[model samples]
Target: MSCYNHSNPSSFLLMGIPRLEATHFWIAFPFCAMYIVALLGNFTLLFVIMTEPKLHHHTSLDLLIYYFLCMLAGIDLVLTTSTMPKILRIFWFHSHEIVFKCCVVQMFFIRSLSAMESGVLLAMAFDLYVSICKPLRYTTILTNAIIAKIGLAVFMWGIGLMTPLTCTVSRLLFCGPRVISHSYCEHMAVVKLACGDITLNYVYGIMAANFVVGSDSIFIAISYILILRAVLSLSSRDEGLKSFSTCGSHVCVILVFYTPVLFSSYMQHWGQNIPTRIHILLADLYLLVPPMLNPIIYSMKTKQIRGQVLRPFYQKTEVRINFY
Candidate 1:
């Protein structure tokens, strides 16, 4: 009860990796490398996409794809940026304490941005479905105005899904030990430190996980199925290959993004018998892996992006953008 009357906000200690404290120095190197790669990859993708005339204005389909790629690259950048530095600090400097309020803020950004990323992937799936399965109506259905609304909806979808959870967490009485058993201010880890009944937190977290992940996974699967059917119906083998090539990057991104996420989320909730170190490792890897790989996946799969990447090596690459 007296904890509720404390003058200062609670400061929680972050354990970078539970059992690998001695190897923090060595571990920091690879994690740091991944962060650097993610930064360069995502930023280069953004710059090249923004400056590439073909991707920007070749066709309405190309334009819409560019817009989504921008959104995806931007999201990956923010998601990694929000949590990785602090994690590195924890690993290298042993800077582990985070204020309760700061923890809440971190929690908000990680949770919301993750959900937003999922929404964007779902949007991408829809875009692919329309492009492949309903090619003629694609232009009519996905104008710039419609794209803007989709972006807004993706942003709001994240907020709507996470706001309640964040608010509930903020209002909880965290009167117990402030030692969080993970690298960052992960929501369940923080919630585990709270004093009172956290049944609502548990239930809401499970439900939200189901609603966001389950539904999006289903829709994405359905979209891909429709896309596959449409592609297979094509009499030309080359056309089917091209269609698969178009979706290959997206499928890879989806797997990279969602596989670890689903594993970590459910394992954290249900895999109590599982070692804490495994969860911590996955959490750290999951944050960095998708961001680092997404751009590389796209670059390898998309010819235009690959050209822009190699362009500077061959010639003085010049890219221009206009502000109106």
Candidate 2:
């Protein structure tokens, strides 16, 4: 079936999901709820971290680490909102047409931010490892200058890695099928619809994803292992538990973010026996679940952040009591 190439098509149709068109209206409800929760939780967490006086101090190493945490929140915000609105649009309103330029932008953000999150988590894990495994050197090692450098390096690396993908996809002539099967413009999904050879896209995409996720996971695992060893060597069990708590929230965040990613990746590639709907759902969950759970996990596990969250309420209560 030879068709003329439309180098500049007006738009592409995004099919919400396969074999579940009728249920899309009902499916929109839970997704909307999760999106609302993610917005509130992540925004509130970002606000508290930014406004809290202690976190603003220039001389504080803790300030840099907390600022880095703010990066995680920002990443979560972008990651969730990047695709969810279009997804909700598809499900609720049957608004499945994404502008061609918009689709390219969406693909860039989704892919770049996913890689950035893995790097951010690894950076945080390394910070935790230093804080726990070498308490005395934590301050000396991860200084404000060093932290700033590390953050810069991660962003440069992530963005640099993903920038080529946009070029590769953009240059492809999309004269073939215009209907994308996924709710959002996933990279491979969009690429598949294009005419001509896309072997580079496939190869680069796989290699880049594996490099970011695989390398980061390895480092994160090593960090946690050393952290565990350090915790065990502590003189007291209470001290060990206390030390472990520092990385607990981070550990939870890593698991939530990475597990679904790996599982979904596998299901889409090798798990041929799995249902398409199931794979799609898992992939969607990979983006949604972590953002929703991250703030909750940190709030519950990290006392400082929890206090930052509750301070305003406590102050209001104090004022009311004093007046009464």
Candidate 3:
């Protein structure tokens, strides 16, 4: 039997997100609080949505919305757990030496969630399209069976798309000067340290983005445009306005979710001179802010959630005000 020693990077120093005074106590403290709130908020939303039968059966879109929200929450957890702790560590101890296996895992976790999120958004878009475009047959077209199938298809797509990415990065032989410029084990950041040919990996990454995220955006845009036209041609202003309002939260959530991702991915590919701080800020916003805002958005937009779920809390506050 022949023994082989696998080549690996010597060491990598993460240029942790920008600093005010390098102590980072102020930055890391707020970020940690945000992570904790994000975790609790998302978990609460998922639990409430799943448990409330009235909320669950409100419309054909309800189930899909719940599923999408849950997926986003899960992504939020993965991102915060993967990146925030590292940032916290740097702030507290100034330790940025990420092991080879941990680096790979971090890269995989980030990419997997980022890519799969596109698919989940696509699923929601499809649900909205079918509900509006094919109103009469919405139930028949998007039966539980069909929803399950679609969920399965998206899952398969996400897994298949991300596998090659993880595999490709894992195969790279790491050596000296393994310092990644970014705070986290971002795909491009880690790949840049490879002492091997990374041209193929870069090409594959671009292709992956185009195939999964690019196509999903195109489809979502088309669906919304059709929905807009359909809404515009309706006779009653109240009916049209109500329908538009229902989807407004979703549209806002989508914009907030995708814009940073598009910006970060674009800069990573095309803009080389962007400030490192901007990159870190955009990535953090892409991962953190959306999850925190999602439940808030939906709660405000959804009458049942606002009235039935949030009303009781508000009423108590109103009572306190009256008492005072």
Look at candidate 3 and tell me the lDDT of residue 178: 73
Q: Pick the candidate with the highest lDDT.
A: 1
TM-score of 1: 0.94
Q: For candidate 1, lDDT tens digit of each residue in 68-151?
A: 888999999988988899999998899998877778778888988989999999999999999999999999999889999999
Q: Candidate 2 on 259-283: residue-level lDDT in tens?
A: 9988876666578898778778777
Q: Lowest lDDT 10-mer window, candidate 1?
A: 1-10
TM-score of 2: 0.92
* Model 1 residue 242 CA deviation in Å: 0.8
Record all residue pairs in model 2 with backbone atoms less than 3 Å apart, i.e. clashing.
none
* Residue-pair clashes per candidate: 0, 0, 3
List the pairs of residues colliding in candidate 1. Answer: none
User: What ranking of all candidate models by lDDT puts the best one first?
Assistant: 1, 2, 3
The reply for model 1, stretches above 4 Å from the true place, is 1-8, 316-324
Candidate order by TM-score, decreasing, is: 1, 2, 3
